[model samples]
Structure formats: C-alpha cells, structure tokens
Target: MKILTLHGINLNMFGKRDPKQYGTATLAQIDDQLRALGQELGAEVECFQTNFEGEMAERIHRAHTDGTDAVIINAGAWTHYSYGLRDALAILKCPIIEVHMSNIHAREAFRHVSVIAEIARGQIAGFGVDSYLLGLRAAVSAVQQG
Candidate 1:
C-alpha cells in the first residue's frame, strides 16, 4: 500500500521546538521511524513536510492523483485550522488518519480542535513519535480492511 505522511507548518522544527511537548525527536527521526514501521507493515510510506499551506494542499492533491492508499497526517498547527488542507484531503478516496505527538485535547484551547477530524477515518495522539508509528499502522490496516 502507498501511504503519504504529512508534517505541516512549523513541524519541521520538531527537535528545536518545545521539547516539553513534542519531545526531542527531530522530524527526520520521526520520518525514519514511520518508514521503518511502514516497511514492516508491508506498506510504502512517503513523507512530506512543508511550512507553506499551499504546498501542503498541492501535495495532498498529488496524493489523489498518485492513487495513495492512505494518508497519515500530523498537520502541526494546520490541524487546528487549515481548511485548504482539509479540502484537499477531502478529495482523496482513501483512508485519512490524523496524528499528534501531543494530546491536542489536553493542550491550549486553540489547539484542541482539529478541522480534519470529521473527514478522517480515525485519530491517534499523545504518544510522541509513537503517534506516527501508530498512525502508519492504522493507515495500513484501514487500507487492508477497506
């Protein structure tokens, strides 16, 4: 299966960002973990990170054309707002799994809402890098059972 993993907005700064919340894992580390887990799950994982909203939306559009079987997204701050990304994800026929290293619901009020939730098949959060790993597994499972 083909899985697209999206890291958005300021997520590129994961390691340098709030270590208290995001932990010390760099974005590259997170991607490496996803790829490794994907391999074990028999899925090909492609990860994309972008600070630009339009670029992310465009990437999601491409995923639609690429016939991606599933998408695992940790859309950073975009998770709370980015309707553009949500709309792009809506175009896909495959499963969408939203993930967060932190527990968004337990964070600030502004961070509590996920615009992507309604359209997503499921959500996994609060497990640091494990969230991405779990998301990948969820994506693979969703594709298999779908």
Candidate 2:
C-alpha cells in the first residue's frame, strides 16, 4: 500500500525548536524511522514536510491523484484552526490519521482543540514520535480491514 506522510508548520524544526517538548529527534530522523517501519510492514511511504498551510493543502489534494491509500499527518499548529486543511482532508476518499508529537490536551488551552480531528479516521498523540508510527500502523490496519 502507498501511504502519504505530511509534516506541517513548525514541525520541521523539531529537534532544534524545543528539546523538552518535542524530543531530540530532527524531522529527517523521524522520517527515517517511519520509513524503516513502513518497510518492515511491506508498505511504501512517501513523505512531505511544509511550513506553509497552502502547500500542505496542495499535498493533500495531490495525494488523491497519486494513488495514495492512506495519509498520516501532523499538522502542528494547524491542528487547532486550519479549516482549509480540514477541508482538504475531507475531500480525500482515503483514510487519514491525525498525529501529534506532544499531548496537546495537556499543553496550553489553545492546543487542546484540534479542528482536523473532526474529520479524521482516528488520532494518535502524546506518544512522541511513536505517534506517527502508531498512526501509520492504524492506517494500514484500517486499509486492510476495509
């Protein structure tokens, strides 16, 4: 199966941005781990990282035409407010699993709400980078079950 992985906003600065909250792994390192996990599961993983909201939306739009079977996205701050991202996700026929590195609910009040969760197949958060792997696994399982 083909899975598209998207990293949004400040996530590109993962390791360097906040070592306490986001851990010490760079975005590239996280992608490497996810890619390894995907290979182990016999799935092809294509990843994209963008700080721009419109670019992320464009990637989501492209996923539909790229034969993507599922999508795993960590929309950073966009999780709380980007209706455009939610709308892009809504348009996809495939399953989408929203992921967060930190537990948003435990953070600032503003981080507690996720606009994208309303339209996602499921959400995985608060497990650090494991959230991405877990989301991917869940997405793969959902695709297989369907």
Candidate 3:
C-alpha cells in the first residue's frame, strides 16, 4: 500500500516548539521512524510537511493523482479550523486518519474542535509521536480491508 503523511503548520518546529506536548523528537526523526515502520509493514510511505495552509491543501489534492492508497494527516493548528483542508480531505477517495501529537480535547478550548475530523475515517491523538504511527497502521489496515 502507498500512504501519504501530511504534517501541517508549526509542526516543522516539533521538538523545539513544545517539548512537553510534542515530545523531544524532531520532525525529521519522526519521519525516519515512520518510514522504517512503513518498510517493515511492506508499505510505501511518502511524507510532506508544510507551514502553509494552501500548500498542505494542494498536497492533499495531489494525493489522488499520486496513486496514494490512504493518507494520515496531522494538520496542527489547522485542525481547529481551515475548512479548506477539511474540504480537500473530503474529496479524497481513500481513507484518511487525522492525528495529533497532543490530545486536543484536553488542551486549549480552541483545540478541541477539528474540522478535518468530520471527514476522516478516524482520529488519533494524545499518544505523542505514536499517534502518527498508529494512524499509519490504521491507514494500511483500512486499505487492506477494502
């Protein structure tokens, strides 16, 4: 299976952004781990990180044409808003798992609402970097089941 992982907004600053919430792993380190896990699972995982909303949306739109089987997206602050991202996700024909490093529901009042969650097959949060791994695993399983 081919999976596309999208990391959004301030996420590029990961480890340095908030060690207490996002953990100590840098974005690159996390991507490497995900890539290795994907290989172990016999799946092709492609990752993209952008601090721009439009770029992230374009990437999602491109996934349909890139032969991606599923997508795992952590839209950072965009999760609470950005209907455009939500719409882009809604257009994808594959399964999408929304992920977050911190549990939004337990964070700021604003973080509790995720626009993407309305269109995603599921949402994974509060597990730190494991959220992405779990999302990837779920994406692979969803594709296999279909």
Each prediction's whole-model lDDT (CA): 0.93, 0.92, 0.92
| Alpha-carbon TM-score of each model against the true structure | 0.98, 0.98, 0.98
Instruction: Compose the digit string of candidate 2's lDDT tens values, residues 1-146.
Output: 99899999989899998787899999999999989999998889888999889989999999989899999999999999999999999999999999999999899999999999988999998999899999989989988987
Winner on lDDT (2 vs 3): 3
lDDT of 2 at 95: 90
Off by over 4 Å in 1: none
Backbone clashes in candidate 2 total 0
Instruction: For candidate 1, list the clashing residue pairs, or say none.
Output: none
lDDT for each residue of candidate 3 in 27-122, tens digit (9 for 90 to 100) = 999899899999998899999999988999899989978899999999999899899999988989999999999999999999999988888999
Q: What is the C-alpha RMSD of each candidate to the true structure, in Å?
A: 0.7, 0.7, 0.6
* Pairs that collide, model 3: none
lDDT of 1 at 73: 95
Ranking of all candidate structures by their lDDT, best first: 1, 3, 2
Model 2 lowest lDDT segment of ten: 17-26
- Alpha-carbon lDDT of model 3: 0.92
Consecutive 10-residue window with the lowest summed lDDT within model 3: 57-66
